[model samples]
Target: MWQQKKANRRMSGGAMNSGKWKEDELIQQMLRIAVPIALQFFMLACVSATDAVMLGFVDQTALSSVSLAGQIQFVLNLFVSGIAIGCGIMIAQYWGKNDPKSIEQLMPVALYANVLFGGVFTLLALLLPEQLMRIFAKDAALISGGAAYLRAVALSYLFCGISQVYLTLLKNTERVLLSSKISSVAVVLNILLNAILIFGFLGFPAMGITGAAIATVFARAVELIWAYLAVKQERTGI
Candidate 1:
């Protein structure tokens, strides 16, 4: 009650903000958006954890190497996520301005930013995987394994560069659940692929850490395609 009264007092002067707190409605709406996103994130963490478990079965060096190489993805997320979220915030501004047409135009800018930053990181991972590995590791075996993993995973960066924009836009467009579903599916696929490829299941050749990276690339590609196909009809440019 106190929080509701405080909200009313703060919102009293602004016509757009003035309202009784529809507590049940507010909670439902928040959960509808938040829960899916949280689940998607948990699924993402599962991808890495699954990789570690599977790779540990193959060799300890591989497990450590992949764990190290995965830091590059963390960095990649930092840059690409910033651009994607910025695009979402800008799109929200368009809603506030009542300028829906301009919302379409923001995509190109976000795409360009994603590609620019993502490309740079991808190139580093692809071209200097060994050198990058040396930064976090000192063991020769670890360096070699991590480098291989980085090169294999570099391609995923390209896929994510484009997919992130689509996913972010989906959330901004009130399709948060859809976006999260796509991501969750991708993560699940990544884990399944990690199993089949890492240990060479179902007649597949064992690829070890390289297979894990390849699985990530394939999962990201699927995510990119799924997101694009889901939203393509609504978008005209890029």
Candidate 2:
């Protein structure tokens, strides 16, 4: 009876160990997805930083003002970006369960919500640039330059929102590398344009700080175009 009991216990222990191993494997798989997403997020932040630096070179006041206005979007973007990833996670799980239709259905809802929010925020930012700038700075020079920068970049909110949803969807669908590549290209374009426009290099007129906002809008346009193309391809595959 003692020997039999010992054998039974050993069997139970082995089963428990196997269950733990399977959990570990699942975690590893999730990490495989999470790691790349984290890295891509970091690279995108770097792109924003580069834009800020390029703008600073054009005019410090403009940079400061834009930075303040940007903070409004940044705070709001936290929610928008969060909703995007949350939707993606749901879609991804559904896809894993072989429910591709759920992905199609969910993507549009997220996209439209962001677009609407973006439109509202863009209007507010553009219309009240000076008021927004005052929240961050008391200096007249800084306020003037910053207001100009904010007004210009505020137009990009709509484009940025639409592109963000699509990009997030692609990431959720396991198209991480492609999304990263597209963002990489946009960052390069932004940096190059900043150099040319900010300093009036390559026959471009120096538009001062306002030029940096234009460069950013141009970069965002490139990003949106790429995202649209990718969405088309994704739809075809689906």
Candidate 3:
């Protein structure tokens, strides 16, 4: 009976060690995925912060207008996020099954849906920016400022819609680091351009709120370009 107890103790100790090692391994894996995702979200948040800070320095109207104008974007993102999440689910499943072809099939469908949604918003912003702004604010000055911002930012919706699909696919395909890098670069560039264009630094004209919109569009374009190149290089059919 004593020998049996000693043997059982040894077995329990070994099992405990194995469980501990697995727990540590799982934590490390979680960090690897979580850190890059966290950083990406942080950088995206900074884009809005940059816009608010630079525009606030210009005037309260500009700041308020952009903030209200951003409501449309916030709504648009909700739809885009839904599409991305759906694509991610399929991609994750296919990836686990090692079925690249299935992922390719789903990619185009997601891209088309996202682009269509983005196009609708772009048209609304371009054609009836003032009306759209009026939906959010009754003040004429606020509506006028928001109209300018919306018109300037309209094209960015198309770019963001396309690029974000690619980013989502890349993340699910185990290219999280690459996607994070691309987003980080775009955010940094947007902030720098916001400073330059909004205040007319480096001999550029001070465009104020319009400049903020231009900066956002340009940064989104950069993201799209980078995503395109990465896709082509990888031949991932994205």
TM-score, predicted candidate 1 vs. hidden true structure = 0.88
Each prediction's TM-score versus the true structure? 0.88, 0.82, 0.95
Off by over 4 Å in 2: 1-32, 236-238
The lDDT for every candidate, in the order shown, is: 0.88, 0.79, 0.93
- Candidate 2: what lDDT? 0.79
What candidate 3 gets wrong by more than 4 Å, as runs, is 1-8
**Top candidate by lDDT:** 3
Instruction: Please give, for residues 20-139, the per-residue lDDT of candidate 3 as tens digits.
Output: 999999999888878999999999898888788889899999999999999999999998999988998899899889999999999999999999999999999999999999999999
lDDT over C-alpha atoms for residue 121 of model 1: 84
| Displacement of the residue 215 alpha carbon in candidate 2, Å | 1.2
Off by over 4 Å in 1: 1-21, 96-98, 236-238
Q: Number of clashing residue pairs in every model? A: 0, 1, 0
lDDT of 2 by residue, 67-115 (tens): 7767877866876788777877887798788887877788788888888
- Report the error of model 3 at residue 86, Å: 1.1
